[model samples]
Target: MSDVRKPWLPPRWFIRLAWSVHRGLYRFSGGRVGLWRPKPGKWGAMRLTTSGRRTGQPRSVILGYLEDGPNLVTMAMNGWGDGEPAWWLNLLAHPDASVQLAGGSHPVRARAAVDTERDRLWQRWREIDKDLDAYAALRSSPTAVVVLEPRAGQG
Candidate 1:
């Protein structure tokens, strides 16, 4: 008999360590390494800087994103960990933020996708990551799909 194999994730500490290492690379490189633009049919990495919900200080992190029309879509999964990512939490208290793309940086406003918007963006993510649902299943709550809309002067 054949059996289904569930998705596997590294230990929580390992996941956290990996994130720290990645952020370290970006910081140590002086903005020279890391971050990329999302290409057609693929997700890309970028640096998202948001204001701390409590401190009002700037907090930055690397994230994967997909381009949808003029907006950017990213997930609020903390490496599929139990709680929502702190960056997402910061966004909730302060939706205004900025993203640094491979090409350039821009001001943006963030919001959680809802209803049909969430459905469509989630599907697009699934297209890029065939294991999308599998990894998300590792978490306790639904991963939020975040939309980064350009400011008034931008697209």
Candidate 2:
């Protein structure tokens, strides 16, 4: 397989379009239609709502995730594009956030997986998606694997 990454990424317009549609479906179905993992994958999906780093307003995005015991693991890949996703950047400024699943929402704190844990999570992603490396190669920098830990003392 070639290491070239350009062809692997979806166009920016497509990304925006898909996101809009997903958000609409999620809202219209009352957390049923677009709440599961993305197509062709077996993981879970959650609406990660974060406070905008600059504006301090709420920002939400649907992401595919895997549950690691009590933590939710997700990759910060913007459709394999070169730029980092806004939600990940937001977490850097303010790690506290909330995740809404099909069942309910929970308070959570986001952090980057480090060292061996990062490696393990990245490998697990590849195991789930055989073309993960090719997609990662599309990015100019390494994609971050974010872990969302449930916050304490929240009902």
Candidate 3:
């Protein structure tokens, strides 16, 4: 598994440090900064709060996301590494979760994209980041594309 070509993953220490800085910036800014894309047309970071699958505790992580009509789309790419992200795994066990955006928090239902939808959304991401597929290729397994749909009467 170590031989898996993960050209996108930075050094492990850098990953940890970057995550801390990103999370700190988001928390410190009250969802204003580090919460969305700085560029005009790109995915922004949001805090996805999920219930831990094993511990059943609230767990939150920052992730880049794209708006898709009524749904929010993200990926299970753990910084372009091999294994799936914890939030995605948690959602698999318990699909109910919450997302914190620049506006506010809302309850959402999580599901992985399928078939043609997956292809379409993947293409959408490609439009945003030309190197998306190249980063995805670094994984030994297929990176799951996750969609977060707002729950009725909840947002």
lDDT of each: 0.89, 0.86, 0.86
Worst 10 residues of 3 by lDDT: 1-10
* Candidate 2 local lDDT, 96-144, one digit each (tens): 9999887788999999999999999898777788778878887789999
Q: Tell me how candidate 1 scores on lDDT.
A: 0.89
**Best-fitting candidate, measured by TM-score?**
1
Q: If both were scored by lDDT, which would come out higher, candidate 1 or candidate 3?
A: 1
Per residue, candidate 1 scores C-alpha lDDT tens digits across 60-86 of: 999999998899999999988789999
Write down the RMSD of all candidates, one decimal each. 3.0, 2.6, 3.4
Q: Which stretches of candidate 3 lie over 4 Å from their true place?
A: 1-9, 37-40, 153-155
Candidates in descending TM-score order: 1, 2, 3
TM-score result, candidate 2: 0.89
Best candidate (score: lDDT): 1
Can you give the TM-score per candidate against the true fold?
A: 0.91, 0.89, 0.88
True lDDT of residue 145, candidate 3: 90
